[model samples]
Structure formats: C-alpha cells, structure tokens
Target: GWARLADDPKALARLPTVAPGATEELDLHLSLETRLAEATAGETLTHGDLYPFNVLLTPDRVVVVDWPHAWIGPAHADLVMLLSSVALSGIDPEPFAVRHPLLTGVEPEAVDVLISAQAGFLLAIACSVDSTADPRLVRMMTELGRSSLRWLSTRTRSSGRSKSKG
Candidate 1:
C-alpha cells in the first residue's frame, strides 16, 4: 500500500523551510490516511522505482531492468518519478508533466500529495546520519527534495502553468 510511504514527522517538520505556502495543501491531503490506497488504485502496472539507472535504451528498443519497486498503481506514479528525476537533472518537468496523458487525467491534488510524499521521503534521507554514505548521494537527495517541493508548489498554486494536452 502507498500508505507505507507516510511522511516521517521530522521530514514533515522540514517542509515549512522548503516551501511555506505548499504545506497547508499538502497537510490536507496527507492527513487523509485512507485516501492514498483508494487514490492509487488502478489497473496500470507501474515500476514504482522507475529512475534512469533502472532503464536501458539500445538502438532498437527500451528495456527496464529493476523490478523490486514494481507495483500495480496509478499510471502517473512512474511518470511522476521519472519527471521528478528530470527535475534533479535541472530540467523543468512541469511542461512535460502537465501535458502527459497519464498525469493530466489524475486529480491535481493527488499528484501533489505523491510529490509531497516523495519530497518527504527524500528529505528524510538527506537528514540521515549514516557516516559511510557518500557526500554526493546526500547532496543529490537534498537537491531532489527541494526540487520536488518547488514543483509541488507550482502545481498547487496554478493548477499548473501549462494547459492540458487536450
């Protein structure tokens, strides 16, 4: 269940520092503990951890390798993950995400919650005190966390600056 991805209280605390205006909207959705399972229910089979490292593209076809994070959930989940990674690479994913078929049909608030959950998860990771972890990894997580929050803020405020692809 997506409920397993609940925000850690400490990470939740850090959100106001990340984006003050977005948290009230985030908190409203996050507080609905029962909605996640219902919201994510879908026939689409999604690779819950779909990032670039798990995908390989050859001259002919694309291959997805990792399966550990695979799950049956909303079609938007994997795309959102990928677009979030796109943000980490310094691209603005909003232009693509707003027009994407999968995301366009999803409730905007639902997507916001997923983005917030990721922001929470990644920021919590950035806060972890494992001395052996690479400095680069910690830095990447912090950057990704901040980017996701910014994206969520943009989404929550404008219903996205980009119009639907329809």
Candidate 2:
C-alpha cells in the first residue's frame, strides 16, 4: 500500500537539508518538541517504532510485534508514526481504525499529529541510513518527511492558539 513518489530523487535530496533552524522546519520541530516534552512529563506512553509490519493479525486476534524501539513516553507518538506510515504506503487509515476499536475514540486531528510525528521520525531514520545511495526509498522518505513537517506545523499553530485562548 506504500505509494512510491514520482519525484523520489528530488525528495531524497531534500531530507538532510530539512532541519529545525530553517524557517520551514520550525513547525515540525515545535510539535516534536512539545510532544517530547509532554512525554518527558509522563503525559503519554511511548512505543518507539510501530508500523503495520509489526502488527500481526488473525481472525478474532490481534498482536503487536517488535519491541526493540519500545519506550515509555506519549501514546500519541506511536499513533502518529502508524498513521504516517499508512499514508506513505498509500493505505487508508480508516479501515485500520475500524478494525482496531482502540483507535475509534481518537480525534482525527490527533491522528494527523501522530502521522506527522511518525513521518518525521521515519524520515530521519531513512535519511540517516545512507538514503542518498538508494534513490527510490530516499524519495519516499523525503516526500513523507515533507508531509510530516507540514502536518506538525499545522498542529503547532492550532495548539498555540488553543493555549492562548485558555
């Protein structure tokens, strides 16, 4: 379900260039920072890396596999990562939510936040893995990373307004 981008080369070339300090990078860094800070304060549970491949399913049973990246932090962090991966892979997340009742009560916007965070993390990992040498995966990571940054920026702005109102 992972959709490959046509502009993979361009996208891969953009990853390392994307970072916090750049004006375009602020929103993502802010959202990640906020979530990380909240996680540090015990606001959420962390499951380092969660993706569909790590999920095992059978009729009437569902199991979460892989624990290497597991940690205690924000639950949203895991959720975001899952959502982003789903989007990147060109899969509809709605079916996943329907099949997994635990996701039912989560707000759509929160899911968006989770996707952003997840995408950013994945991008960072992909970029770090010598992505420059692998053009296809590099492009996928780059495009996904860009989407993640945009999502983070939106979430940051919305949260900022909410805090100001309160």
Candidate 3:
C-alpha cells in the first residue's frame, strides 16, 4: 500500500478530497516509517491485497487467488488487509482479528497503521480517476473511498487521534 502511494504523486495530491489534511497526515506517518518497519522486522510472505473478493473456497479447501500483489513482508500485514476488507463489508473486525493466526504477536497500533495506509491508498486512487470514463466503476470506487475514509477516522479517533500511516 505504501508502495502504491509512493508511485502515485498525482493521485496523492488529490487525496485531500476524500481525506482532509492528507499531506500533513502522510508526513507524520512517513516520520514513523522506521518504527513501523521495526514492528514487522521479519521477512515473510504477505498477500499484499488480501480481501474477500480475492479468496476462493471449495468444499475441500480454501484458496487465496490473487498473487500479483504478493511480496515479502510481515504476515500480520496480510491479516490487516483482510480485516479492512471485512470491515468494508459491514462486518465487525474484532472477532476475526482475535482468531487470526497471522495477527499473533503483532502490535494493535501497527495494524491500525496498515489499515489507514490501505484506506488512504484507496482514497487516492478513487479521487484521481476520471469519473466520466466509467461512471459505474467510479461510483463504486467513490463509495469504497468514503467507507475507507470513515473507517480511518474511526480508527484514528479510537487510537487517540493518531495520524494515518502513509
């Protein structure tokens, strides 16, 4: 998610529409990059975009189908992305978070940061696109952006008003 943000300066520039104070918020987050990095020190496989839509389940087994975003990162990062998607689906994340093995030994604050980054990246992309080019897709992105932003705000406030992680 951070890599996505880093690669899209134009989109990042338009993020304030969906996330107010995005520049300062991202700057504060950037300052804590090393700490965030330290929190997930091990090199493990991560499903960079783990979400409900990317998973497939059969009678016999579960399969995670999207591998393009796969990379070496903290295992908890994949869990965080999964929880974020669940939250977007109007599900409470607490129960799932408690049971997920990937979240073992992970800091709650670190998860919050990852979720915020995911929200911010989505908002940037949603705001950057040309709406008229594809109204239905744009509308979907807009709604997703709004939900993600709301989730970000709720997480921030609950976490004592911390700025988002870029």
Candidate 4:
C-alpha cells in the first residue's frame, strides 16, 4: 500500500501541496522509483517498524520484537524507520544513522528513497478525503510526514544533491 503510493508519480507530485513547506521535496523525488526498485529488492527481513516500543535491550545484545510489517526489503529500511522515530523526539538522528553499522556500505540514494517514499505515503494518508481516521490519527500522520520530509531535506542538502524540475 505504502509502496504503491510512493511510486505513483501523481502521489509524489502532490507531496509539496500536501505537506506544508515540502516544496523542495519535489526536487528530491528524481529517480526515486528507479532507485527504490533496486534498493528494496533484498532478502533481508527488515522490521518495517523499529521504534523503541518494539525493541528490547539486554546486557548481552539488543533485540527487536515486532514483525507484523516485516518484509524482504533492504536492511537499511529498518534503520531509516528507527532514525525517523528518533527524529520525532526532537533529536536529529542523521549523523548517527549514516555511520551506523547497519547502514554501512548502503548507498546514500537507497536511504533517501525510503525517506521520500514514507513521507509521500504518510502525508497522502493525512490529506486523503476518504480518510475516516480519527483526528488524532490524522494529526499524527501529518506530523510524522512533515518530520520525515525535514529529515529528507537535511540529508539531501548535506549530500549536495537536488534535481531541478524539468
């Protein structure tokens, strides 16, 4: 479902208007579908939801508990989700995310696509007229969507990557 919306050109194009202040994200969508096709094609079982609530800490090692959204996607997808949850706490997690052992050797564009996809999907849900979702749920989606876009903006700018609309 999220992937469908993410790869839709109409959905990507609507992101700027759906997410306030996300106009610059319009440029970030360049090649997103192509890159995602490669990055997300993997055998790894990423959690798809890796927030603290689903994680456990043991003296010996860390553990992940949730599996409902698990998928055969890039390992870095979980890392991106983890970092996104961290960002919601008002802390910037990019610096640590980039160098984290999990994301080691992962392409920069791979990470960018996940952020873009999630941002687009989340914002779309919040803006959807058919959404009978609660106001609180809608608000949460909107906040997380905006947060994801901000994270994307920071990552793209730091990497000196931006595509001008053709």
Measured by lDDT, the strongest candidate is 4
Write down the worst ten-residue block by lDDT for model 4: 25-34
Candidate 2 ranges beyond 4 A from true positions = 1-23, 26-35, 43-45, 89-117, 131-144, 153-166
C-alpha RMSD in Å of predicted model 3 compared with the true structure: 4.0
| lDDT of candidate 1 over 55-129, digit per residue (tens) | 999999999988987889888988887888888787888899889998776877677657766766676666543
Cα lDDT of model 2 by residue, 1-166, tens digit: 0111113554345455653322344343444444533333335556666767778899999888888887775455566667656655655544564466545665555554455445555565554565346777666656666555555445546555342221
Comparing 2 and 3 by lDDT, which wins? 3
- Clash count of each predicted structure: 0, 11, 0, 0
Instruction: Give the alpha carbon lDDT tens digit for every residue of 63-138 in model 4.
Output: 8897888889876788897787778788898988867998899878788788877766677676553456798877
- Which one is best on TM-score? 4
Q: Please provide, for model 3 over 1-166, each residue's C-alpha lDDT reduced to its tens digit, 9 standing for 90 to 100.
A: 4445546887777666655665556665454443555655568888777767778999999999878987787868877766666666787676677678887767766766666566655665666777565767665555555555555556667668556442
lDDT values for all models: 0.67, 0.52, 0.65, 0.72
Identify the runs in model 3 with alpha carbons over 4 angstroms from their true place: 1-36, 39-41, 131-146, 159-166
Record all residue pairs in model 3 with backbone atoms less than 3 Å apart, i.e. clashing. Answer: none
Q: In candidate 3, residue 91 scores what lDDT?
A: 70
Cα-based TM-score, every candidate = 0.73, 0.52, 0.69, 0.77
What ordering of candidates by lDDT runs from best to worst? Answer: 4, 1, 3, 2
Residue 150 of model 1, lDDT score: 72
